[model samples]
Target: MSAPRGWRPAELVADRFETASARTLRLRVADWPGHLPGQHIDVRLTAPDGYHAERSYSLAAPFDGEFVEITVQRVTDGEVSGYLVDGLPVGASIEIRGPVGGWFVWDPARPAPAVLVAGGSGIVPIAAMLRARRKAMADSPFRVVYVLRDPGSLFYRDELADEEIFLAYTRAAPPGDPRLPGRLTLEELREHTLPPGPEVTCYVCGPTGFVEATAAQLVSLGHAPGAVRTERFG
Candidate 1:
């Protein structure tokens, strides 16, 4: 599959709910150019009256064939996200243009240790990087720190179970877990994330506030400013 130049037709082939408000969609794009880990795609939906709604979603997995997967987080009153999460049916058609973005991607060839920090649905792209790393059989050390409102809101729960992942719950912690429910603290970052160093590359994604705050924490811990890469959404 080569990357299509503009918007191309995508047919929904599979769909599943990852959380109460998030759904993963698998679409087969005939001309889909494979995407790098951490790249995103633009999805567009058109109404019968010529109304259009568009949104960008991060790729959820490494490209294997003509299909691409995206996990959509339903916003409170979001048009595109709402439809993609709840209304789009299997076999339906949508337009997609992508493999967009380059700055946030992870290259398996890099030998530096990776620290992934995700908030809410931000795990979508991080999961792709993790999957790509495994697919490539890279030996670089990788760590993940994920923060969500509760256990129920965590995406890829089953898929990421065996990875080197740490969790921080904001509203509720699972039974037997020692940490109480609260926002991610600097202490947690210091304890769970890779030690500050030049050879460590950090990727942080989530809502704008979370990305900014987490990046600041990493810098405060002595990581070089240029070594930290970030992507943010609502």
Candidate 2:
């Protein structure tokens, strides 16, 4: 329950474009305290004139004392995201704070089934949870419902795939796909998501509207209200 560590200089050691509009940055911080799956950090960029632009970004990978990874989706007029996604290159130093947030995290050791739902770029944190779950070799099963505008827009598109994840396309389904092109509906949610039960832990992250609807649907499907944890973005 203690506060996360303060801002420290983080050097971008590597970066790659995930999509035309999004990029992932690999930062090497001097003294990272390590982080849990689904936690986030505060990134600050200052202009030469002392103007500050700060934003919160979810950790895109699991914790293991390696370099920290944060995925950024360019916001139309967002100063920080714009810089991170398009301008930041290797060796750039940025001020980063905490591996923050406690309630919305996943602990691999916990004996519970995890139902993860992500919308748009919200997959960043859930991707971390998935990585941790895979690396931990835990027995707990994980099922994911990832909603994206299209296949090309998926972050970590190759790593997280079918068999465990149900990719839902809202704007357009991949060529010849049967799934309709629309936002995730409660019907689709119930069909693709787990059968709600007391032992299942649900984590839904996305834009505000997506988070609200998914959480509500999970509750309506018989899961405990307390078991559904959510984080909203944008």
Candidate 3:
């Protein structure tokens, strides 16, 4: 398939801290074509020496006019992530091309129940799906399972408060939290997720290992292999 038009200029109009190491940047792109939920953009940064660095970031919200949002997680020794999280100023400029990827996207018209499994920064696209659903006022049910290192690492905490989210804290738990700190177990997964059915679709995104393991668990729980979709990133 053909790709998006050549990189267009984008300017960071606003930003907010999701965590100490992650930030959500809102960019206004020239001639933006708009994007579906779960799509991503390729961002390019050029230095004074004419060096160019590029990275892919998932859209963090549904389409909004000529503006788009992406959440960046700071990675140690990462060429693009580090600058996106800490170095890039609010008004700085970059180039972006996308609305990339057709699969792993949620359609508001489809009534199938959705199961979203997200690990760390993988929640960005999933969050976009949720936002899109709300914007469309669709009645399709959605269940979200987010895995994080601790309470402090949770993204979009305020916005997700009323959503049906099952959070698993791996390394630490806040005071009064019921679940203990540990990796998500199969038993816990079964307890939180919907029973596999013909009309249910599962979307898992995260690190490669996490996505693979989670998808396997879903299949083992009787979910059809084709019904389980996944997207993984480093």
Candidate 4:
């Protein structure tokens, strides 16, 4: 439960996507320590006069080794994502503290049946959980339902295309896509048929409104309240 050692950002590299909305930043730190999947790191920026701002971003890469990968989605007025997407460059340094947070982490040693619900940028941490699951060969049962506006805006498309995975689009449709279209509704969730018992753990993350609505729907569909765990990002 202790905070992972903090490190200074030692380098930054840009990864441009076909869509301008998504970009991956590879951050290198000086003596960066390892972190469990689903843990997040804090990035802090300061003004010339030393006034500061910070944000917590989940690690997107697998937990195999050194360096951390954080995939950031630009928010309209977000200081961190705005700078990370448009201004920060390789070799730029910043103050970072983490791997912080405990409630959302997915430990390989204790994998359990999991249901992950992500909306938009909320997929960051869930992606890391998947990586850890794959690496550890954890027998934890898994199902992910990622709700996004459209296919073009999806964070990790190909990596989550398994039959067990479901993508619910609330906005535009994906061509030739057979998955459901529209927001995730309580009825739809019930139709999907979750782990059919009380043993499943549901993890939901997204904007505040989405998390609340989804958690409500899950509970309404007979999922035990104690079995549902959530994290919200504004």
TM-score for every candidate vs. truth?
0.96, 0.95, 0.96, 0.89
Model 4 stretches with alpha carbons more than 4 Å out:
5-7, 13-18, 196-198
What is the overall TM-score of model 4 with all chains considered together? 0.89
Rank the models by lDDT, top first. 3, 1, 2, 4
The superposed Cα distance between candidate 2 and the true structure at residue 17, in angstroms, equals 1.2
Question: Which tens-of-lDDT digit does each residue in 92-169 have in candidate 3?
Answer: 888998878988888765656889999999999999999999999988878899999998999998999989899999
lDDT of 2: 0.87
Residue 115, model 2: Cα distance from true site in angstroms: 0.6
Candidate 2 clashes between residue pairs 3 or more apart in a chain or in different chains:
none
Q: Name the lDDT value of residue 36 in candidate 4.
A: 77
Model 4 agreement with the true structure over 101-215: per-residue lDDT tens digits: 7777777777878888899988988888888898898877888888888878888766776536677899887888776578888766766646546668888889999999998
Off by over 4 Å in 3: 1-3
For model 1 the local lDDT of residue 21 reads: 91
On a 0 to 1 TM-score scale, where does candidate 2 land against the true structure?
0.95
Candidate 4 residue 57 Cα shift, in angstroms, is 1.1
Error of 2 at 152 (Å): 2.1
Q: In lDDT terms, which candidate is top?
A: 3
What lDDT tens digits, residue by residue, belong to model 2 across residues 81-146? 988988887888999988899999997767478899999999999999888877887778788999
Candidate 2's C-alpha runs over 4 A off are none
